[model samples]
Target: MQNYKKDFPIFKNNPSLIFLDSTSSTQKPEYVIEWICDYLSQSYSNIHRGLYDIAINSEKMYFDSKQKVADFLGTHDLKEIIYTYNSNYALNIISQTLRLNKVLKTGDKVLVSIVEHHSNIVPWLILKEEIGIELEFVRVTQDFDIDFDDFEKKYDEKVKVIAFTHVSNVTGKIFDVERIGKLKRPDTLFIIDASQSFPHMKLDVPKMNCDFLFFTAHKVMADSWLGVIWGKRELLEKYKPIFSGWWAINEVKKECFKPGALPFKFEPGTPNISGALSLLKALEYIEKIGWYETVESIEKELIEYSLEQFRSRPYLQLIGNTESKKRVWVFWFYIQGVHALDIADAMAENNICIRAGHHCTEPFMNYLKLSSSARMSLYIYNSKDDIDAFFKILDTNFNPTWLTK
Candidate 1:
């Protein structure tokens, strides 16, 4: 397997650190970090507000970053991409805008799944309370996959919106978004949260048939506090932005105002210029490594190796599909009679970093009858050696008798 750890400086600084929580956030690459520093030091200015050389350059770089995001999502329309704080902010904007636009009225239904993160679920719940809309959830099968039968049965003309995650943050199971997107009615809107999938796979927005998709930059090795929301041109034009400011408007009177065009309308303030530039550099880093040809293969091999090690340790019970091919490298597991916090603290003491919590999916945890679980999510920098070391720690530290006792 390729050793991509050299690209990230964190591993070099902490020689014994074994980071296995990339699903939550990835460590920054040297390339992205340097670019951010250089851009801020050399050409830092507010964009679209000035015509000076540095200002023009900064504005160009910001839009260029947006264009790069558009290209990454396989969309030709740059105007369709809007910048926000994160996926959570993006979802809130969509829900509020749809409600304000009358696209979602009282008694309308929104279909989501039990596998969604709190970011996707809470917005709809709030909308339900505010607008009297009905919120429904599609169940998960025993294998930790979405129940398509339940989805189809619950979906009908009254279901005005369908929102789901492309990959479950806890299970790493990739949903069949194309199938669900294609199955929806013409008038129904489809929204996808690609926080876990965008960094690992190539997604074609037009081909997915979804009206809107959103993801955060931090998960893809970029800076945090930046996100992208890509929507269909017509849909974006139809919905008025819930938030407005000086840059987001064309004209304003004391009583009313006209919102600006596609992206600017939704983006209402001094944006995260450095965050966007960092995302551009992160995408470039992915391209440099040949994401589809190299990174994906490396992650697959790591998943297989990790699963093999997991199987040998019978005390560890995985929460999702046992097959590596069916999921990403994220694994959530538990030991009988051992608390998740105890396992995570033990791993931390051994210089291994893994996450332990409900993983922002309390509903899914409730569905599985689990209070919490320990998660180890792999990324490009992880290797078989790391997995072996992890298992070695487990073998030396945890035993069935101690766990049961």
Candidate 2:
């Protein structure tokens, strides 16, 4: 019931805007924006190479942010974290580096679930095409939850790697990562895509037992173009740099060069300095606002309220788990005989933003026999009023007559 929208400037500017698409990207808070602007205007400089006052300060801030990221993820080792362009680039780094270093070879198997985003699937598919590695997809149940029986059956000694998402972007089902982590073979590496879950939950890398994990900053109220990759030191040191340049080199002769240390070897060239600062501020803001106690409680309340509202409307067919406690704030549903795009356009006309598409999981969509669905993802800034407004639009604008047609 608390009003958290005042922290976001977008709501003040667009009074009628009801944003329900935080899963795609979250709106920036005033705290993060002001910090980014102040840093850029007063002390902006390229990091790691300059020796002047501003340069030294900038380099310190950059590395301090990396350290903050490591601490936030429950890890103390700074060398384990690598900043990249985004989650897509991070996954590609892992795949390509493993392939080039011969860590992943032909005839090996990689296991993934059917409810993964393209970012997690495409790199492995390309690897399958390039090498002789086999790609297998675990099935999902009718309710959109992971079929753990099938997963256990498919997982074997041949599977050298297991890559999966912590939460499904389309279905909002929280995967049992701890269970899977315990089931993994000692020699097989486990990777996690936390882009969807990081914003809504508390994540500890050691507790999850993943060899590698990555997520984007934009989804957590930070600026875009920054992603974080955390891996075990030993595994990261085993693979050579997939892309090497000025900052990632240790020593350079005329013909060959040695790669630098853990993170620098992976993060080549000039990185996103301002964006990294923004992430530091964003994490600070979340902590200051009591992320676990306050932000998570608000999201849970919104989810329960939204599900209660959905129960009153028989026309709206909800997808995924119906129980509120089993999922996050993402919800996907459709009205029978109504095209998803048309529903989205109708909501847009009412100044309510929602997404209707495959949501980058075309294979899962194909499996469900659904081309598209309307998705409403909430965040800390949302409230029960937003849910009421969304249902109001559906009730008054879309009637039984229209639904039947």
The lDDT of model 1 is 0.90
Question: Model 2 — which ten-residue stretch has the worst lDDT?
Answer: 396-405
What lDDT tens digits, residue by residue, belong to model 1 across residues 1-405?
Answer: 796899999999999999989999999999999888888888899998898999999889888899999999999678999999899999999999999999999999999999899999999999888989999999989888889999999998899999999999998998999999789789899999999999889989988999999999999999999989999999898887898988899999999998998779998889999999999899999999886668789878888888888887788998887898668889999988878898888889989999999999999889888987899989989888788777776766676755476
After superposing candidate 2 on the true structure, give the runs of residues whose Cα lies further than 4 Å from its correct spot: 401-405
Predicted candidate 2 versus true structure: per-residue lDDT over 1-405, tens digit per residue: 774799999999999999999999999999999888888889899988998999999888888888888988888788899999889998998999889988789999999999999999999999999998998999988776778899989998789899999999988988989888898878899999999988878888898899999999999899999999999999888888788988898999999999998778888889999998898889888888986668778977888899898887888998887888668888899988888898899899999999999999998888888977899989888988899899888887676955477
lDDT of 2: 0.89
- State the C-alpha lDDT per candidate: 0.90, 0.89
CA lDDT of 205 in candidate 2? 88
RMSD to the true structure for each prediction, in A, is 1.5, 1.5
TM-score of 1: 0.97
Residue 400 deviation, candidate 1, in Å?
A: 1.7
Per-model TM values vs. the true structure: 0.97, 0.97
Steric clash pairs (candidate 1): none
